[model samples]
Target chain A: MDKFNVGKHISGKFNEELEAVRNKVLAMGGLVEKQLADALSAIENSDVELAERVLSSDYKINQLELEIDEQCTRIIAKRQPTASDLRLVLAIIKTISDLERIGDEAERLAHVAKASFNKDQEHLLVSLENLGQQVLMMLREVLDAFARMDEEAALQVHQMDTNADRQYEALTRQLMTYMMEDSRSIPKIMDVMWSARSLERIGDRCQNISEYIIYFVRGKDVRHISREAMEDTVRGAKS
Target chain B: MDKFNVGKHISGKFNEELEAVRNKVLAMGGLVEKQLADALSAIENSDVELAERVLSSDYKINQLELEIDEQCTRIIAKRQPTASDLRLVLAIIKTISDLERIGDEAERLAHVAKASFNKDQEHLLVSLENLGQQVLMMLREVLDAFARMDEEAALQVHQMDTNADRQYEALTRQLMTYMMEDSRSIPKIMDVMWSARSLERIGDRCQNISEYIIYFVRGKDVRHISREAMEDTVRGAKS
Candidate 1:
């Protein structure tokens, strides 16, 4: 029996509590996903107002994190859950922390979008937007994996970190070229570079979330392992 | 009694287990602290070997994190500890994660040092070096606070984060000036900027560790609260 099973407990109320906590996590993930999307879209279309909206809504994500964090703590203190149940609570704690960090990155991107960029700086913004969209999609898929607790899907998203890294490298190089070509634009270009860095980090955070899903499913800690090793373990494990 | 108490539990063996787990965390923290010091010193002295050493030692910190994580999980599972003991286990889990990330920032700083830089870029390196030292000190003090589980000390260290942020902002402005003055050094300047960012994050992580200490001693979730309020809560508590 999987630890994430819903409504399968001897105590129906306990099942409902677990299920409610899981739902709250999903709801938080959804809000974070939207913030990233809007930040990326705001940068793409240069919508300062939209970016402002994303910034204002970040507190809700933070609030959810605190609330969910307390709930998990209470659950552990009260349930004194064993084995898989303990793992589930621990994973929730780690996942929410990662999600809260993702929200912080989203806020940083929104700040970049809120910064006024003119026509000359549009190319760098375009490159940032492209890399950001890749991260955003990765985040979306990871959340889906999180929702389904699908280890295979989580593995796929984890591998996508390489693509995001390559894109970030390219963007960094391009931003440097622009800075060298016109030193006057150094400040503005730095803003775009910071946004690119945030996107790459968001990609990493998504990878982390994916790994948490893998751990929750496989009862294995895949962090700091080589890809081949993780893949072998994932494929070898019985679902 | 405080949750971080070393020998207060009824079961002497359980007390020993908790103490062992705590010692492991402190050991891990000490390793991360050394990594940061070596990275900063390597930057200041232009010692490539020292930087390489920091990079190689990072894996040890990661290994400790995994080891400590498993031990904490096992403690929770076997002990089914409630109240303070449970909080101690949970706090250990969270603290190790932050310590692991601090090691990552140290790795980034080492890479920046390993990248060769000429004398002309010395000023930017000096600025980064200065900022790196501030973060290093913060890391050290936070770990000490953690060791003692001293709420007052933790609060003191937490307020020092503002100083680190101010230093980071000044360094960022200085780097921007260097980039604009000579576009030829733009790439090198960008590397320094990334190091500065990493140092800033290390500072934030130190603050997080301090908060965890406060939470353990006070039974309060002090995250996301205003500084004034956190101060009031910390000083207002009966600890």
Candidate 2:
């Protein structure tokens, strides 16, 4: 999408190495996305079996992360690819790290599902599942954006985090009100609040992955920048 | 400390580049450590001014992270460091990312301090500040281990996360009890819970840094490993 071309490398093998590493990252992303979906499913239906599956599946995502990390280090040492190629490698490194952490958050969310909530707390679980679904959608879209290295799509995903945060804040306020109204349910509501917090964090991780995609495509570090500034960087680049 | 001799690189310029990047990371670590200290101080005393300062100081840590990240990327592009040298660069990259997130948690702690707590809620903040100090010590130790790439010390710091987690759980349960006992304090207690969660996360980030130190020295991916396995990796490596 940018000026640098991975396809035109002098060594076709080197191009393959980069492609292979990126593919591994995408594969890891796919597994993590599934884990999030499963975690949300478990939470929604209070499926302890599904939640256990998500927990054990986390080990696989961690394995994929380490495997891909080694491959990236090997490519860097072997190919010594410069410019956008190196940026791509660095972005993959960072993207996988975020993906692994998303898997951790998913595990935590799954734990919330395992907790036996009373009948009165069912509505709180429903609210958490609502937010969980929103975060799941964001994760799916960000992974899609990363797959295409689409700067425009990445920017859109980044902006969507604002809505996710709003949902999370609303849930937190609702949980607090629920606790105040029925103090005996405070312990259960607290667990739901933590789950809501984990969902919010998953949104932030997706936003981080989106930034990495933009960094790879645009050769600019868009992190720590204002939303308007990030938009300008992503939109103003010459294609 | 390991098999690599960074000081004896044939290209003294490359040696300088590597050394310079490592020093920048230490400097950034120093800044983040200070931010954590100030945030804790603000929380203990309810010093809004100091809390604001910690919040502002977060920008500096973020800027330093960006600067150090660019330096690492430039080193890789220019030096093409291989083997241990490349691992050092990678470790530096990953360490700074964790450091930056630690800064974010410190900013979150600062916000907790800025909130006006009721006089009755003071003891909860005291417990939070207790856990805050424990995490602060862990951060300090991890930074020291990272500075030396001391695998032994890193292992020690990594083990400390268990204590931090215990403290966090204890604080969480205590807060829940307080919320149940006095439902009127639910909102304020929830903020304290968030702060305690931040402290626990800071502890995890420190554990990550400790793992990075061991990886830099031992050339192993110790993440997601058992405590015993990580110990074997860190302690069994040849120096």
Q: What lDDT does the true structure give each of the candidates?
A: 0.89, 0.89
Candidate 1 lDDT tens digits, A103-191: 99999999989888778878778887678888989999999998888889999999999999999998889889989998888899999
Most accurate candidate by DockQ: 2
lDDT of 2 by residue, A1-239 (tens): 33347678999898778778778888999999999999888888989999999988899999999999999999999989789989989999999999999999999989989999878778889988668888998999999999889989999989999999999989899889998999888888888888898899999999999999999888999999999899889887653
DockQ, candidate 1, vs. native dimer: 0.82
| Each prediction's DockQ against the real complex | 0.82, 0.89
Each prediction's total of clashing residue pairs, residues at least 3 apart in sequence or on different chains, is 0, 0
10 residues in a row with least lDDT, candidate 2 chain B: B1-10
Candidate 1: chain B TM-score against the reference chain B: 0.96
Candidate 1: misplaced stretches above 4 Å?
A1-3, B1-3
TM-score of chain A by itself in each prediction: 0.96, 0.96
Give the fraction of reference interface contacts each candidate recovers: 0.76, 0.86
TM-score of each: 0.97, 0.97
Off by over 4 Å in 2: A1-6, B1-4, B237-239
Docking class of 2: high
